[model samples]
Target: MRLWLESAVAGTPSWCLYNAVLSVLRATSALIISLLGVSMHGACVSAAGGRLNSRQRFLGSIVVAWALVPVPGRPQDLSRVEQLYEEAQSARTRGDFATAERLYIEVIRRAPELANAYHNLGIVYFMQRKYEGAAEVLEQAIRLDSKLGPAHAMLGLAYYELYRPEKAAKELQAALRLNPSDTNVLIYLGKAELQERDYKAAAKTFEKVAALKPRDPEILYDLSLAYMKLMLESIGRLGEAAPGSHQFWLLLAQDAEARGDEEAAIRNYQQALRVKPDVIGAHYGLGSAYAKIGKYDDAAQEFKKELQISPDDWLALWKLGELALRTDPDQARQYLARAVSLDPDFPQAVLAYGRALARAGKTEKAMEQFQRVVTLAPEEDSVHYHLAHAFRRLGREEEARKELTRFEELAKKKDERTQQMARRLIEMTRAAQPLADEPEPGFSPSRDPTHH
Candidate 1:
């Protein structure tokens, strides 16, 4: 190749030089094949040349040959671009960012339309936490190759890091369209939906993720947070729509419930229903208050009403299952099973369903449910206690003992956390306002009333 360049300096035409180089390359390939005792057509540059096969040998030789010679006036020197890309990737793997950046930038300069080069350079910028720079390069990559899913993904992440959720969502949706089963794209889409306060959309998106990777606490937690925010936003919107209607009173009852005023909350919720019998959320709020006060029968009725109004309410189903657990295992099993089927990752509903399964003499099935509960909510003491009981019932003494020990440890930690939280609440209350002027009247004396 160097000799060909020397001849070029002696007034050889570029086309003639290119033909001479091609002839020399073919001669070298034929000589090497003969010397290595391998067929020139089916070679792999290995011992006896039985390794990488024809396609690999062909591509490998092309890469080597391209690195040794510069092809001018071509649309793209793909071999040179791929070789540089491989070198950049090697440098990136070793965390040599400077080398990677330089090589990738050079690849882009040589092949200005190389999407992979721009994509990798964007990743290098992202690794350095330069989100703005990543966005710029990744956008260019997307322009070069609209089907480049990874470029869209990186651009979405960059936009997210730059606090541009709408753009992030758009780019993530594009990426997800290209690569439908990507968990990272789904997670980031959920995050963008959440940041935009599209709670229902976020919950639905996270539900797909939860189904894909069950027992992932982070996904479950995000789903739960979305549900909670959706609930709060619903109430807030209801109040905004009807300032003095039954919905507004229902909001007040919810506030009362939040303040631990179960009896008053129940009364307020009842009044709300009386004001507007078909009011949304009133029945559920009343049911929750009744459940808080241990009025299981009353709670069950209210939940039944809510379920009639909204047939797919998993929370209503869960409450009904809880109300029937001690009295009717068959009925509890039906409700809890349906609740679990509706929202399979729901930890509390799963715990209740496990208890019902145990009552129905399905010991192994009960154990499975309890184990799922542990996976879903390892911090919950009730699941551990019930699981220990389930293990004992199955005569798994060692497993039972382990669960009991875990339960004890978790209970102690939970108690300490509760105490700390209580103290913090008291301090916050003291700092919020003076003692509420000795507490408002008509508050129930037994907020945590024991079941009769």
Candidate 2:
């Protein structure tokens, strides 16, 4: 049994587990049981097990270990054990883990079958960072009461700390099956999945957490990282299977666009179009990149080509409408009206339509569109800016002033948000860079227990 547990720990990558669990353990104490301790007899029993592939020997040892626990003979002794258990619970709550550990040992000695005592003991061992002890006790706890979800979760966390991701994932999954809404367990399981390189499963797990806490930056970051890993895997396979294909160029263009390399994006997107002119997104991507570089005529031509391929593309129509607003307001309105009708909930299209209406000398209609944009995106600075202009044109001075003030406030906040995002991007890039002292590829260093 000892050999099996050590092998399990040795099989996992320690660095991977360290990175996976460090971010998650911040809220671990709050998520786990309040009462906890480790059983002395269980620890002593699992201390030595050299027999490998001998289930009969392991089972016999377990039976002997169980037989060694002292069970009380009277009801009064049982009541005394309950009193001692309560004292251990108090000690654990007060952070006196030593006293709690001692009292819990006494409780287990009196009532050997009490799974909660073992479960609580596992929690104490976990808190003390004695993960081997924690795993042993938690396993016993689970064996005694298979339905104990907390025990399962605690055991999984211990396995994670011991660098046993496969076992950790299994136990964490079991815990989730018993309580699907346990977000902390879900987080641990997601990290374990990530360590295992199961990117799709990790993404799904993080998505569930995102659904529950939509604004959590850590959860969002994990989900994005998982998706980025999945994208890299897919891109690798695509490159191996279809080198220099139009799809490959299109993917590269989209990646360049996301990285804000508009010039590279335009080049790749054009290559995609040259390879397969009828590809769905190639023209639009090329046009967008062209627009970013101030080539409006080129952008307009590409947008028209995109429309030729997909006549009902609302995004293409919206781009054309935006490009025409500076030169031909009436033509802009024509294109934007169709775009807005196709996707009325889109704030950018509605805002552009309002701008075109204002330029066409239709102030009332423009004001209506601006109001609608505000409802669709109240926090959007440009929407408020356009609404302010509409109000000023209508001689509503006070309302225009209010809208301008709101626009200024939102613009400031938007600038701060952009700066924050830039900082986060830098941090993420730094995290992905190879370490200065990293070993060469294909090199394997001897395991260092002190690394944990």
Candidate 3:
């Protein structure tokens, strides 16, 4: 029975376990033969046979002789942990933010020390517009990996969104310290400084960004705005009695107009133009501002002056078209057509041309212009709504309804102006009525309203 058990153990598939059992049997037999005072050569032969049959017998004999054997430690199972982390990363890449967040939470629960999971989860929260939740998760990430620059940067962004500018500044500064060349961090720091009204610091930050990205128009525009703001603030500190004060005020006006501060900005621009009639930007700025304030006649005169200086100024032509639209649709069409001829991709010119056609009751032609706008920028809900109205006027009820539905869906993601236009379009299309009950005193409808 003992021999049978030994043979069975030796023949097992697990060679290491089989060898272990053989080593035990051989050691016991060798000890028994030594105590019996029999010739040990036969016992040594039996042990040699066991060693020849077993893989680990030689190593086990050496270990037993030295009394120095290593005990195997427990194998770690990381399969579940690995699977959760992988799922979290995959979900985030696909923009499935909710699922990504849940998976990240699971990973954190299973492996509390996984800093990357917390960081990624925070990013998902940020993408979902959950600023407070993002802040919390990112804060935890920072605790786990205090030196992680990305976590600091993200925490800064979250704090900025939460109206915690002071904390945002600290985190952003830390991120910058870790990666001084990060343009995005620099831009955020500048924005945070601007929020804190630290214009000087903001200017310095933006200057660094501008240095890194010299030809970026947006950065230049922002830098220009900051300079203009500083100039205005400087002038505001001085009373009118300050020497050369007119020049200061004119400079302030030019800067304000450049930044789109229409009314006061226009006054300053006009002042600058009056003081130096050859100032081109001042003339353009004054004309554009006049058009914005609905002073069309004044705008037309200013634009004419601008054209005298720069005959091919497309902006002047577009502004003239916008001014003409309120009074003369035909003339507006002419100016807008000129602007389009100069720059076919001009969105403002396209919009104005569509408005001109609509106002003139040329609904079909109006629709062509609006359709062009949608083709040029499908994201523009106003263009869709305008096209819908044109379709309704042209008696294409189904197309009009389709465009109106599309406009509403797009409008839900729109700003105030576009939303208002979409709502007006919806009301008009649903009521199936004209905007006006009677034609204006001298103007006549180009087509019968009842026909549509």
Q: Scored by CA lDDT, what does every candidate get?
A: 0.74, 0.74, 0.70
lDDT score at residue 242, model 2, on the 0-100 scale: 94
Model 1, 296-320: lDDT tens per residue? 7888999899888888888888888
List of clashing residue pairs for candidate 1 = none
On TM-score, the leading prediction is 2
Pick out the ten consecutive residues of candidate 1 with the lowest summed lDDT. Answer: 4-13
Off by over 4 Å in 3: 1-251, 254-261, 358-365, 415-421, 436-452
Could you tally the backbone clashes for each prediction? Answer: 0, 4, 0
Q: Determine which window of 10 residues in candidate 2 has minimal summed lDDT.
A: 443-452
Query: Compared to the true structure, candidate 2 yields what TM-score?
Result: 0.63
Over 230-266, each residue of candidate 3 has an lDDT whose tens digit, in order, gives 7656776663556344466566765575566788978
The local distance difference test score of model 3 is 0.70
Better of 1 and 3 by lDDT: 1
Two-way TM-score contest, 1 vs 3, winner: 1
Q: After superposition, how far is residue 265 of candidate 1 from its true place, in Å?
A: 3.5
Write one digit per residue (lDDT tens) for candidate 2, span 396-432: 8788778766665665565565434434433442354
